[model samples]
Target: MSTKQENIKQLIEEYMKVNQMGPGDRLPSETALSQSFRVSRTTLRGAIRQLESEGKLLVKHGSGTFATCPLPSIPSSLDRLYSIGDMIRSAGLREDEQLESIQRISVCPPDIAEQMRFSENEPMIALERTRTANGEAVAHSINWMPEKLAGPILEGDSFSGSLFQSLEFKAGVRIVGAYSELTVPNYDDAHMTRLLKDPQATVLLLKQLHYDEMNRQVLYSLDYVRSDIFRFWVRRTR
Candidate 1:
């Protein structure tokens, strides 16, 4: 890192510290920051983008950048990739899953079908599970599978069990890529009320379509993550 960059980074840190800016808080504009520090706008932009990629900030479309979830490491990108188990375990957290509902059902909603590439009326295996880290409820996940493949999975799976393992070992399938979307919402639904403490809790929802290495969609999952306990990052090449 260059000395100029180091100085600019320190400036950002000082600003955040002085403002007591926690996650999701908006930061000052680059123009304001540059003027305050008597630096060029390009330098300020680089610094802000650095903080963004570092997970210290998030650049929202149309709006200025805001403080975001804490950054653990550049390599552990919870959003870009990683299993739920791996994502939590990589953060030095002890994680477990509580199976709430795991049942076979026929017919998925059309919107859901569009996301998972399934017909509007396909039979699917629906599994709703809660993920706990350090004995606290951190996330709730719902997974859907095709009936032909998922009809045989029993409920004897433990908290330490991997869903991928269950799928591959029991049903003979592998997961490769996932098409996912992340958002923060005011969680006040029945599931959130039962599993979380606050009705106003901010949740990081990850809606994913899990595809195998052969490029066949296998699983549709909805991961509702606690914004407080978990954070995810994304990296882009300049």
Candidate 2:
């Protein structure tokens, strides 16, 4: 790809982002895009062809070009445990985080404490963040851990995206497994809808109890995943 083609591709992606274009959204006509970008038709077509080859755009004869899904749907297996960041990376998307939500020291609630095998009033470091893939919100996560294990994270600025990575590298704790429960949520949350950028989005709630190598429960988490962007499956042998 020449520099001009790459630049044009980036511009087209930006245009899609700005317009909130999702799968099946049609792009402007080639002439219109060429005129808007001030580029010749040949260059614009080159960029479009590249995007089409990459499965980001689809060109149908006589039907025009349309945007494919901006991010690939993650097909996760139920037999294994994966961090949010790991899942996003496996889907060939850039994993990013936005910590604009709550991250603070708080007392663990009774139900969560019981799940973590901690006292009801146990001190915990609670973190709530929106996980993004290629700058698009994909999941919202809320995690609670005993303050003793994750206390330093609250005071430091080392957290980039993955809490699992941060825990292993910073706190010397490695999560080996988890007990998970998955469900489809029937309630509407305006806050989550706004963050996900889709008012009609369906959400899958995943609740997990994480255990370390020592077989000690260390973390409890609630992950609200955008069902449209992620697909979870399990293999069954009869």
Candidate 3:
């Protein structure tokens, strides 16, 4: 969270505390809160989302936001990497379906090439897909990989399972680890909004760079996760 978000969160909490708010109590309107805190609606919404993710606020669509008792969340440890399918399964929801598009690009995007350590002219494969659990879309992902490494699998018709598994089996490379960063995207994407089936949805953006056992960057992915459906946490020690 950014400093402004943190400050807004603190202010909201204090407002609830000072008002003797409890479960089932409704908070002030968005306009009211924004004016009271002197922050933009976007910033206010972000803070509300942060609080909602922590089980401190309940946002009932078409209704007002309300105070709520802490609710159980699907806990994901930050120490390990899990495929989107695996994460859905672990949440006890059936990994129902995926809609995908794949293409071979002659030139890689500069930023992606830089991250994956590819030469400017190196070809790559791009995969974009939306993953659903129990009939509800939970994540949208775009992945890029060196063509030399993933071309074989892309050429085959049996590429219906996890990308991680496909790379290990067909591509013959084991992805041992990944570096991931999480953030709340500040802008709304029309395509993503439609895919997730919610125009006002709060989304968490996760960027990951996966490496093989040889420590060579093999894949880079951008995953947009629905905050209402998933939550992740990291342990910190002093």
Candidate 4:
């Protein structure tokens, strides 16, 4: 989380504490909180949603959000794997997908080829997109898959939703699992800074190798996530 977001979260917690808000107490209106904190509505909403994710708040549609009594045990986001669309919805925001580019290529980049275990110069399909949550850009993803899996995708009318879902629906290739590494990305990178439009924002760079049901590495992806709007977690078990 960014410093601004953390500060907002802390501020809210203090308000709850000072007000002696019991479990099931209603929070102040969004406008009120935004004005009180002198933050934009967007940032305030993000902080509220983060609290809800932590089981500190309960949002009831058609009803006001409430403080949870005894705060429910927030499930680990790591426990149940999710697609990008799922992640947005879980954060209580609407998801919008923008397809930037899609094409077939004969020459694979050396790094990508190594990850996919493909021979260099082999043909493949590239899918590029930007995902927004509630109209705020949240992630940019570029994916590479073998040409054989591209048939059904190419014949489709729209590729605007989940690429993993489309690949499964069209080609019968399911993304059963993935091995992912997360790191803080260089915001100074010219292209990424321009695309995301936040040169100083902290972001998560997720490099993942998606596997099929048979445990074959069938897809490779690079995803850049805006940390303020999205949070990724891991669960450790004995």
Cα TM-score per model: 0.62, 0.68, 0.68, 0.66
1 or 4, which is superior by lDDT?
A: 4
Error of 1 at 234 (Å): 0.9
lDDT of 4 by residue, 1-238 (tens): 5678878989999999999998889988888998999998888877777777555777786687788643111122654557777777766677898887787888888999999999987798888888877675677888898888776777553467677788888789888888888787764654355334332346678788989899989899888876655676777789
User: Looking at model 1, which ten-residue stretch has the lowest summed lDDT?
Assistant: 71-80
Instruction: Output the TM-score of candidate 3.
Output: 0.68
Comparing 1 with 3 on lDDT, the higher-scoring candidate is: 3
Candidate 2 residue-wise lDDT at 36: 100
Considering every candidate listed, which one attains the maximal TM-score?
A: 2
Model 3, C-alpha of 236: deviation from truth (Å): 0.9
Clashing pairs in model 1, backbone N/Cα/C closer than 3 A: none
Worst 10 contiguous positions by lDDT, candidate 4: 70-79
Tens-place lDDT per residue, model 2, 119-177, is: 87677777878898898788988888888888755556434557888888889999999
Q: Which stretches of candidate 2 lie above 4 Å from their native place? A: 1-69
Q: Rank the candidates by TM-score, best first.
A: 2, 3, 4, 1
Per residue, candidate 3 scores C-alpha lDDT tens digits across 1-238 of: 7799989999999999999999999998999999999999999998898887666888897899999765234557778899888888887877855647787789888999899888979998888888877776778888899889888777552246788988999889999999999987667564357344334457888889999999999999988887777789888999
TM match of model 2 to true structure: 0.68
- Residue-level lDDT tens digits of model 1 in 53-144: 45477778689889865634313464455777777887887778888876666778777788777897888777888887767677788888
